[model samples]
Target: MAGTQSYVDDLSGTLDERLIISSTPQRSNALSNKFSGVLSASYADSEIRDALHSLDENEIKNTAETRRRLRLNVQKQVIQRNGAVVQEYGHVAEQLKRIGAIINSLTACCEVMRQHVTAARHENAPVLEEASSLLVQKQELETKKQLLDAFNKHFIMSEEDLLVLTGATEAVDDTFFGVLMRVKQIYVDCQVLLGTENQRLGLELMDQSSRNLNIGYQKLYRWIQKEFKTLNLESPQISSIIRRALRALAERPTLFQSCLDLFAETREHILTDAFYSALTGSSSGDNQNPVTKAIEFYAHEPLRYVGDMLAWTHSAAVSEREALESLFISDGDEISKGFKAGRQAEPWSAGDDEAFDGRKALGELVNRNLAGVARALRQRIEQVLQNHEDAVLLYKIANLVIFYRVTFIKLLGPDSSMLETLSSLVQSALRQFQTVVSDNASAIQAEIAAPTPDLRIPAFLDEALAQFTTLLKTYDSSLTAASSSVADFKSIISQALNPFLATCEKMAKETNEPSAGIFMTNCLIAAKTTLSAYDFVQDRVSELNEQLASLTSSLVEYQHAFFLHTSGLHPLLAALAPTEDTPGSLLNISTLPPFQLQPLTDAGQTLDDFLPSALMDAMENLKRLGNTKLSQEITADAAERFCEDFEFVEGKLTAADELREIALREGGEENEKEEQELVPLRSLFPRTSGEIRVLLS
Candidate 1:
C-alpha cells in the first residue's frame, strides 16, 4: 500500500476563530468501528500519556552520563557559573580548615570533631546534621570547638558538567515526590552560579522557561493527529490531545473549538430538559441545578461572557461554568418537520394549486432524505408546498387545515363559530375525495393564514400551532386567495366543452361552398345531429373511465384474497402477488420472477410478465366473454376481401361491353352492309339503338 500523510492547518479566515484545514483524504486502511477515546481516564489522557511514554527508555533513563552531559551544557550556558561556585566554596572551606587546625591540638576528641567538620564543609551540600549527631560531637569538642554558634554556612553554585550527558533528567526518583522540589542539582546549581539571583528568583525563571515546551507538545500532538487520518484509523486520541494542549495554553482557535464542542453537549442538555419539561409541565426556569445553570449559561449567554473566562484557567467562574456545561446540554430532537405539500388540482381551480420551490431550500431538504429535519439548523423555510409521493403529506395537510380553521375562528371571537364549522366540513370533504392528494397544501395555507387572524383557539392548540409555524415568513402575501369552487367547476365545464369544439373545427374545414340552394331547415337538422354525436362521445369516455376504476377496485380485492389463499406459495413468490391495482390494465406486463429482480436498478418489469393476477384474470375473462365479437371481427376482414373482388369484376364487365362495340365498328361495312344493303337512307335514321349514321357520298 502507498503510504499516506496529511497536514491540518489552522488559518484565520472571515470568522474570528482560526479554521483548521484538513488535507484531502488519500486511500487508507479501511475504516474500523473502533470506539473513540473520550478521556474518561485521567493522567492527561491516552494520547498525552502515550506520547510521554513513547520517549525512548534511553531518553527517559537519566544515567550518570546523562546528568554529566546536562551539567556540562548548564555549565556552558552560565558564564563562570561552575568556576565561581567551586572557587568561592573552596575559599570558605580553607578558612574553616585554618581555624579548625589552630584549635586541633586542644584535645584528642576535639581533633576528631574538627576532622568531621572539615569533611562536611568539603561536600557542597548544606551541613544539616541531625541534633543527636551534633550533640554527640559537640560534647567531644565542648572546649576546643570554640562555641561555634552555627556551623559555618557555605553555598556552592556547583556544576556537575557530565550530568546531562549521562541522561540525568530521566532518572526515576527512588522515592515519592522526586520530580518537584527534589529536582536536579545541576538545574539548581546553574541557577545560583549564573548572574545575581536568590533561590526564589532561580525557581521562578525555571518555571518561566518550562512553559515554552507546552507549545511544542501542542504542535507535536496536532502533527500526530494528521498522520492518523492519513493512516485511516478510527477516532484516534492524538488529535484530541493536540487540541487539549492548545486549549490548555489558551490558543484561541483550539479554545473556541473546545467551546464549540462543549456547546453541542450543552445545547442538547438544555433542549432535552426543555422538551422533557414541556411534557412534564415544568417551567424553563427550573434550571436551578449547577449543571443546568452551566448548560443554560453556555447556550444562552452573550458571547462576551464566555470569551473573557476562556482566556485563562484561573478564571474560576469559567471553570465552574465549563464544568456545568459538560453535565447536561442536549441538541434538540426533531419530532416533525411541517413541510407543506398539496394535491395537483385542476388548472381552473380557484382554491390552491400544488406547487413547490426550493431553489434555495432545495439544496437543504433534498439532501435530508425526509428524515424530518437536521438538528443543526431549523428544518428551513420553503416558500412553496413540498411535493413528494407520500400520501401521508396529504392527510396531514387536511388535519392541519382543520387545526388552522378552528384556531383562526376561535381567535376571531364568538362570531368565529363559523370557522369551526367550516373547519370540520372541510376535513369531511377531504375524506370523500377520489384522488388522494399526496402533498402539503393545508400546511402551506395554514402557515400563511394562521397569524393574520387572532381568533380564540384552544390556548394549548394556539401555542402549538403557532410554534409549528414560527419559521414561516412574517410578511403576508399580497395575492388574494379565492375560496369558491367556481374554478373547479370551470375545469369540469372545459372537459364537457372540448368535443363540441373539435367538431366545429372539423366541420368548418370540410364545408364546401354549398350553393345557397341548400335549404336552411335541413342544414339545421344536420348541425343538431353532429352536436349530439360530439356530446355523446365525450360522455362515453368519462363513463368508460369510471367503469375501469370500478373494475380496478374489484380486481384489487380479488388479488388480495388470492394471495391470502395461496399462503402455501414459496416465500419469495408470495410477495409477488397483485397489489395497488390502478385503473389501467397491465395484463400484458412482462417480468422476471420477483426472485430474480433482486438488487434492483432503473429497469422496470416488462408489461407482459408483471401483470397483476386480478388484471390477468379480468383480461382472460373479458376475452372469453367477447368471443362473439372476435368472430365478427374475423368475418369483417372477409367482407373487405369480397368488396375488393366485386370492384374488380365490375370493371371487367364494363371493359367487355366497350370491346364488343369497338369490334363491330371496326368490321366496317361488311357486317353493316348485309343488314343495311336493303335499307333506304330514312330507314337508317331509326335511332332506337342509340346510334346515328351520317354520310355523304
Candidate 2:
C-alpha cells in the first residue's frame, strides 16, 4: 500500500515540475525537441529531471503560465466534444423516428390512393341494363323525328282547299292562324267526325306563310327560276342567310320610333316648353331669355288655359305689362314638377288607379346637374361684368333689379317683398317708367324733358342714403346737446330778469330783447328747424346747407365749453370726446378739438373756432345795446337795472343749486311740503309807491 501511494505522489510531482520548467518559449521549444525522450523516459526516471534543469526561474514562470492557459483550453475542448457527441446522438434518434413515420405515412397514402383509383375504375365501367333502355328510347325518338321531318318537308295546301275548311268562301282580312283557331274550335264544339272537307279546311288554315315555311320546300319550288339564277344546293349555309334576310324584312321599324325620332330634339324643347307651361301655364316666346320668360310666364298663365280674360288678369301689379314681367323664378324643375305634377298627374299615392301614382321617379330632378347650369350662368355674368363693364354692367344690374323688385316680389307672395317693400315697389315702378321713356327719342324740347336714370338710380340711392343717415345721426346728436346748453343759459337769464320785475311795466322793460338776445334766439331756432327737417336720402338734398346753421351754433357752444375748461376758466368740461377721423369727409369738422375760451384778450390770438367768436359776438352785441341806451338820461338807471337783473338771476340760480344739493345730500326735495310751513318773506314787503312813510324803519 505505501509503495502504491509513493508512486502516485511521484507521478503528481513529475507533472507539476515538468509544467513549471516548460513555461518559457525556449524551454517549451527545447521540451518539444526532446518530447519523445521525455515522454519515453519512465515516470520515476531522472532523464525528465535533466531536461527540466535546463530552465531558469523566469523561464519556469512563463512555462507555468503557458501550462495553466493550455490546461484551461484543453478543459474547454473536452466539454465541446462531449456536447457535439450528445447533439449527434439526438440527431440520429430523430432521423430514425422521422424515417419510420415517412414509411408508415407512405403506406397509408398508397392504400388510400389505391382504394380511390379502384373505386373510380369500377364507376367508369358501362352497365348493360341502362344501355338497353337507353337504346330503346333513342330508337323510338329517331322514328318519331323522321316522321315529323317527313311531314315538315312535304306539307302544302292550295287556296281552294280552304273554303269549306275555314268556312270562308269569300275573301277576308282574317289571318290564316285565326282560321286555324276557328277549325280547332269546330272540333271542340261538335265532337263529331267529318270527311275530306274538314281535313281540307284544317290544311287550308295552315296559311300562306305556312306553305313557304316547310323544310326543303324552297329547293322543290320553281322560284329557283324566279331569281333567274342557279340554285346553290352545294352550299346549304347560304340558304340560312336567305331565311334570315326574309325575317329581317318581316320585322320593320316601329311606327312610334320613326315618328318620335323625327321630332326627338325638337320634342325635348317642345316638351320642355310644354312642361314649363304646365307648371306655369303660359306662352311661347321669341328671343326672351328663358329665366326672364319663366318669370314673365306666371304673369301670362291666366290667359293661356283660363282664356283671354284670365290671361289679362294677374296676381301682380296690373298697372303695366313690364311690372308683371320681372319675376324671380328659380329654375329648379324638380320642385316645379313636384308642385305642379300633383294637379296634372296622380292625385296622390295609394289611390285607385296605378297610373294616377305614375310619375316616373325622383331621379329625373338631377339637382347636381341643374346647379352646374346655374354656376355656369354666374360665371358668364362675372365674365361680362369683368370684360364689357360700363355698357353691359349697368344694363344687367338694372334688369336684375327690376326683376327682383317688380316680378319676383309680386310672384312669390304679396308679403315676400315686405322688407323694404314700399321702397322696392316704388323703385320698380320708376325703373320700368324710365326704361320705356328713356330709350325712346323725345319729341319735346330738351329743357322740358325729365331725365330718366339710364343709370342705377335706386342702387346709388340706397348706397348714398346709407351714408347720409349715418352722418346725419352724428351731426344731429351733437347739435341737440349744444342746444341744451344754450337753452339752459337763456332760461337762467329770463328767470333772473323776472325776479326784479315787480309790475307788468317793469317786466316789459326788463324783458326787451337785448341785441345779443335776438341773435341767440335766431341762431338756436335756425339750427333746430333745419336739423329737424333733414332728409337722409334724395328727397331734400338741398337741406344739407341748412345743417350748417345748427352745426355752427353747436360748434360755438362746444368751443366755449372747451375754452372754459382747457383755459382754466371753469371747472367742468374738456374737448368733448372726438369722433375718430377718416378720409373723404365733406367736412373736416370732425377733427377740430373743442377750444378753451381764453379771456377776450388772451384769446385775441385767433378765434377761428366757435366758442370764442360766439362769446365775443354776444359781447359786442351787448355793447352796442349799451351804446343805444347811452342817450337815455338815466344811463345809471340802465346800469342799475342790469345789476338788479344779474343779481335776480344769480339768486334764482343759487336757489336751484341749493335744491339740487339738498336732493343729493339728504333728498330734501322729498320734504318740500313740510318746509312750505316756514314761509315768512311775503309779510315783510309793503305794497310799493308809498314814498317812505315815516314808519318805514
Candidate 3:
C-alpha cells in the first residue's frame, strides 16, 4: 500500500512538473485551477493521513486496502481495453483476407478480357484487308466513271455529227457513206462502254442509235427523191442513177422499202395522169390520136419501167427470203426445211413460174394500168360512135376494139376484165353500124318510092351495097383476127341486110307500079351481086336470087294474062265452048252462017300502049337472062316460049276464017251421030290445026 501511495505521489509530482515545464502560464493556470480542487482534496487527504498516522494503525491498514482495491479496478479496466483491441485486430485481419480475394477475382477478370480482345483482333484481320481492297476498287470505279462520262459525251457528239453529215439536220450533203460509217462506229462504242452490267443503259443507247439511223435513212430518201425529180425518167442517166441508188440502199431494208414506196407512188401518178389526159384528149402538143398515144405509151415505157421496178423488188424479196431462211435454220425451225423441200419437189408451172419469176409484180402493175387504158379507149370509141354517124369510123372503131381485146388477153391473161370491156365496145360499134345501115336503107327506099323515082336510085343502091360489102369484108378480117366464128359475122350481116332488103320490098309493094318493080328488081340485083361477091354472103345472095326468080315468074304470068286480054281471043274462045242445051252435041257451025270477024285494030292498039316501058325493060331483063348461065336458063326458056306463043297468035289471026270453016265442018250431023265422042279440041279444030286456028282462025 505504501509503495502504491508513493507511486501515485511520484506520478503526480511528475505530471505537475511536466505541466510547469511544457505549459505556458495560461496553461499552467488552467491546469492549476483544474487541479486546485484536486490539490485541496489531496491536502485534506494528507492532513487526514497525518491525523490517521497520529490516530491509529487501523486507518493505515484501511488506506492500504483501498489502494489495493483501486489497483484491482485499474487492472480490470486495462484487461477490458486489451480485449477490445484484440477484437479490433481480428476484424482488421478478416478485412485484409476479403480484400485479397477481391483482388484475385479482378485479376482473373482482366486476364479473360485480354484473351477475348486478342481473339476479336484475330477475327477482324481479314475484314480489314478486305476493306482496304474495297477502297482500292472504289477508287478504280471512280476513275472508270469519269472515263465513261467523257466517252458518253464524245459518243453523243459523234452521233450529232453523224446526223448532221447524213442530212438528218438541215445541212444537205453527199457524204452518206461516211455518215453511216461514223454512226455505226459510235453505236458499237456505246454498246461496249455501257457493257452487260449496264444492260438497261445499253438497250437505251441502242434504241437511240436505231432512231438516228432511221433519220439518216429518211434523209437519204429525201435526197433521192429530189435528185430523181430533177432527171428525166426516160434518160439512160436516170436508170444508172436508180441502179446506184438501189444498190446503195439494198443492204438497208427500211431505206430500200422507203425508196421502193416512193417509186411506186411516182410511177402510179405519172401513168394515171398521162392515161387520163390521153383518154380525155386534154393532153398538150400531140397530133396523134389520144387512143393511139395511150396505147403506145402504155405498151412501151410504162410497161418497161414497171417491169424493171418489179424485177428489183423481186430480187429484194428473194434476198429477204434467203435471210429469213437462214435465220429460221439457226433457230431450228422445221418450217424452213419443209418449205425448201416443197419448193424442190414441185416445180412451178409456166404461168406460175412467170408469176413467181421477177415479172409477177410487174405483170400486176402493167395489167392494172393497161386495164385502165383499155377502159378509157373503149369509152372514147363508144362516145365517138354515139356522136358521129360515120360508118367508116364505126368500122374502124370496131376493128380497134377487137385488136385491143386480143392484145389485152395476151398481155393480161384471160382473167382480166378489160377483155369484157373490149367485147362490149365491139358489140356497141356493131350496133351502131347496124343502125346506120338501117337508116340508109330507109332513105334509099324513100327515094325509090318517089313519084318521079330518082334515076340515081341504082347508083345510091350500088354505093350502099358497096359500103355493105366493104363493111362485111372488114368484119370478116376483124372477126377472124378476134377469134370470132365466121357464122357470127354472117349472122350479124344478115340481120342488118335482111331488114334493109325487106324495106326495099315494102317500098316496091307500096308503089305497085311496073317502074317500082323494075327499080326494086334492079336494086335487089345490085345487092345480090354485091353480096355474092363476098364468100361469106354467097348463101344470102342465093336466097335473094331465088326471090328474084319468083318475082320474074309472076311478072311473066301477068304478061301472059295481058296478051290474052289484048288479042280479043278470050271472047272467041268463050263462044266456042260447048253449050248446056247441046249436051253431047258440038257447036253447030254448019247450020250457023259465016260470022264476019272484026279487024279489032283499036284492041291491038290498046294492047300495044299497055305494054309500058317498064314491061319493055322487064322483057329486056328476061332476054338478058340468057347470059346468066344455068341460074337463069329456066327464065330464058320461058321467055322464048312466050315469044313463040306471040308469033303463033299472029299467024292464028290471019287464019281465023279458015279456022271457022274447019270448026263448022267438024260439028256436022254426020260427026255428031258417030258412036265415038270427039275430043273438044279435035272436034272444034284438028290436031293439025295451027296454033293460030285455036286462037283467031
Candidate 4:
C-alpha cells in the first residue's frame, strides 16, 4: 500500500515537472542536451532528490512505470491537439483554392469587358461625336431661350399694354399710366435697338409705338378736355391724377395747346357767365347772391359800377390762373421728364431743349379766359366815362381802369389782350376827363376871369381845385407807389391838376396889383398843400413854390413902394436917386432944393407922423392877404423897408445940415437962418435909424 502511494505521488511530481519544462523551453532544451544519459537528469535534480527523500526503494523502483504511463498520457494529448491543427490547416487550404478560382474568373471577365468596350468605341464614333454636338446645341438653346425671355420682358410691350394705353373706354387710372410709361420706355429704348445690326425690328417697333403713343396722347387730350369742361376752379384741392395726366399730355405740344384752347374757351364762357351774373344780378333768371350786389344796381353811381365790374373780372381771372397753375405745375418734375422724352424722340422739336414754361402758358390761358369779360368791362367803363360830366368821377374811373391794368399785367402778361383793352379804356376815360376839364376851364375863363373883390380865390377856381383834390386823392389811393414812373405821374398831374391851376393863374392876371398877387398866392398855396402829400407830385409842387416866390417878391416890392410913398420919403428918394452919368453915385441931395433944411424939416415931420402907425398901416394896406402868417411876414418886411427909406431921409437931412453949418461958418449969418430952421439933423427927423429898426423889429 505504501509503495503504491509513493508511486502515485511520484507520477504527480513528474507531471508537474513536465509542465514546468514545457513552459520553460530554453531551460528544458539545455537540460535535455546536458543530462541525456543520467536518470537523475530525466527528472529534474530537485525532483529526483525529492523522490529519493520521500520514497522507499520499492516505490522508487515503480518510478519507471510512472514515467512510462506519463509518456503515454503526453503522447495521447499531442495526438489529439495535432489532429485539431491538421484539420484547421486542411480547411484553410480549401479556402485558398476557392479564392484562386474566383480570381481567374474575374480576370477573364475583365478582359472580356475591355474587349467589348474597345469594339463599341470603334463601332459608334460618329454617334458619340453627334451626341457631343447635341449637348452643346442644347446648352446654346437654353442660353438663347433665357435671352429671348429677358428681351421679351424688357423691350416689348404686349398687346394688352397697348390696349390699356390707347383704349378710349379704359379709365385713366394708375394702371393705364404705368402701361403708358412702359410704352414710352419701349419707344425710347427702340433707339438702342436701332443702333444694333437689326434696324428692321427697331423701325417696325418705333413706327408701331409712335402710332400708339399718338393715339394715347389723343385719348388723353380728349380726356383732359372733358375734365376741364366740368372743372370746378373754385375748389381748393385739385386731383393729383388730373395733374399727372396733364403732365403726361405736355409731351405733345400741339395736342397740349389744343387742350389748352378748349380749356380756355370753356373757362372764358364760364367767367363771362359769372361776370354777367354779377353785373345783371342773374344769369338764368336766378337772383344774384345778396352778399354780392349786382354791378347794374350801382349803375347810377358810375365809379362804383365800373369798379364792381372790374373787380369781378379780376377775381375771375385770378381764380382761373390759379386753377390752371395748380393743374400744370404740381407735377413739374413729371412734366419735365415727359418733355425731355418727347424732345429726345423728336430732336427737331426745337433746336434747344428748353423745359416747358408753365408761367407763360398760364398767363395765356388766363388772358383767354378773361377775354369774354374784357370787352364788356371796357365798353361799360367807356360808356360810363363818356356819359359822366364830373371830371373827378371820370378821373376816378380812369384810375380804376389803370389799377386793373397793372393787376392784369402781372396776372396776364404785358402783351395780354385784357391789359391792352384796359389800357385803351384808361385812355378813353382820361380823354373824357381831359375834355371835361377843358370845357369847364373855357366856361370859367369867360365867366369868372376876374378874381373876387376881397382878393380871394375865385369861386370857380375853388370848385375846380376841390375837384382837382378829389382827383389827386383818387390817384394816390388807387395805384401803388411803384406803379407809375415820375414821367407818367407827371403826365397824370398835368392832365388832371394843371388845367385848374392854369385857369386860376389866368383869372389872377385879370385882377388889379396887390389883389392879383394875393389871389394868385392863395391859389398856389392851396395847390401846393393839396399836392404836397404825394411824393410823385413834388416836381409840380416845386414849380408852384417858384411861382409863389415870384409873386411874393412882386407883392413885397409893391408894398415897399406904398410904404415909401405914404411916409413922405419919395421926395427924399428923388433927391437921393443915383445919377445916370455917375452910374452908381447917389445924387448930392444936400445941395438940391428939395433936400434943403426946410424941405428936410417938413419930411421929418411927415416921417414922425408915419412912424407912429407904420406896421399897423402896412397891415391895413395888405389886409386882403388870405394867409395871416404871410400877411404878418409881408407887413414886417414892408415896415423894415420903410425904416430903410427913413434912414436915407435922415442921412440927406444930416448932409444938408452939414452943408448949412459950412455955409454958416464960411459966410457968418448967410446960412444961419437955414441952420436955425434945420434945428440940427437929430431934432428935425427925431427918429434915428436905431429907433426905426427897434420899431420894425
Q: Which one is best on TM-score?
A: 4
Backbone clashes (count) for model 1: 59
**Alpha-carbon TM-score of each model against the true structure:** 0.17, 0.19, 0.43, 0.75
RMSD of 3: 32.4
The root-mean-square deviation over C-alpha atoms between each candidate and the true structure, in angstroms, is: 43.4, 33.4, 32.4, 11.8
Worst-scoring 10-residue span by lDDT in model 3: 349-358
Candidate 2 local lDDT, 596-657, one digit each (tens): 23232232222223223433343343342212332121223332332343233233323433
Shift in Å, residue 389, candidate 2? 5.0
**For model 4, what is the C-alpha lDDT against the true structure?**
0.76
Which candidate number would show the highest lDDT if scored against the true structure? 4
Order the candidates by TM-score, highest first — what do you get? Answer: 4, 3, 2, 1
Give me the runs in candidate 1 sitting further than 4 Å from their true place: 1-255, 273-657, 663-697
- TM-score winner between 1 and 4, please give it: 4
Which pairs clash (backbone N, Cα, C closer than 3 Å) in model 3?
A: 652-692, 655-697, 656-696, 656-697
Provide the overall lDDT of each model, using Cα atoms, as 2-decimal numbers. Answer: 0.31, 0.34, 0.53, 0.76
Whichever of 1 and 2 has more TM-score, that candidate is 2
**TM-score-superior candidate, 2 or 4:** 4
Query: Cα deviation of 65 in candidate 3 (Å)?
Result: 99
The sequence of per-residue lDDT tens digits that candidate 4 reaches over residues 1-697 is 4665566567667866876667655665655654444434444468766655544442435756665685575577679989999999999999999999999999999999999999999999999999999999999999999999998997777878878888889989898889888878888888899999979999998898888888888888888889988988888867877888888887876676688788889988888888888887787557556776677877667777887788788888877777768765666666767777666555667565677666776687788888888877777777777777988888887888888888888778899999889989988887887788788777765765577778776676678678877876776787756545456667667766677677777777786788888888988888888888877678888999999999888888887887788778887677666533231232244456665668768987887788778778877867887788988887777777777777776666566556556656776676667556645655655678898888667
Which residue ranges in model 2 land beyond 4 Å of their true spot?
1-264, 267-382, 388-649, 652-697
Candidate 3 local lDDT, 175-265, one digit each (tens) = 5555655665677677685656767876777677767766765676777776645544443233333444444443353454465555545
Give the per-residue lDDT of model 1 (tens digit) for 275-304. 333223454676444333342234332222
